[model samples]
Target: MKNLAESVNIEAAEIMKIFQWKGTTDQLTDEEKTHLKYEIADTLIYLFYMCDQLKIDPVDVMKAKLEYNKGRHWKKDKE
Candidate 1:
């Protein structure tokens, strides 16, 4: 299996391509959707590696961030 950093880098590159190809209508081509999946996977791979390096658990961090954001109750204000 490929290592985490390599996987993340590969996915990050795909994300760049997606940005380059995005449509104005908020619709995505099938290939773009597939690339998006890879982009998310790549980000997760990097997050996991960073957590491991810091001796942290991914789930714990995720839960903590979720709780923090929930408490903040962020929303977009309409103009």
Candidate 2:
């Protein structure tokens, strides 16, 4: 679980760099793109490992969450 959390945090940081270091991810260098890809893969790997350890089906959880979100409304940030 700790690893899963850490992986998510790392992934978030990598994504933040896209917005903070550059205007968008579209202009990321090849190395930066590769780094981001690996970070995302690491997050998914940790997530799946944790799910397996807990005997959880991530697909089912995501499906349920998607359905639950359908009834919720999000306010757009004032830009």
Would you estimate the TM-scores of all the predictions?
A: 0.64, 0.72
Model 1 vs truth, CA RMSD: 4.3
Error of 2 at 72 (Å): 0.9
Instruction: Sum up the clashes in candidate 1.
Output: 0
lDDT of 2 by residue, 1-79 (tens): 7877787777777677655746544587788788778877877887788899889999999999999998877776433
Candidate number achieving the greatest lDDT relative to the actual structure: 2
Q: What is each predicted model's overall lDDT from 0 to 1?
A: 0.76, 0.79
lDDT per residue as tens, model 1, 1-79: 2566677777777787787855677778798798789788878878688678879998988899998887564456322
Alpha carbon deviation, residue 54, candidate 2 (Å): 1.1
TM-score of 1: 0.64
lDDT of 1 at 31: 84
Displacement of residue 53 (Cα, Å) in model 1 is 0.9
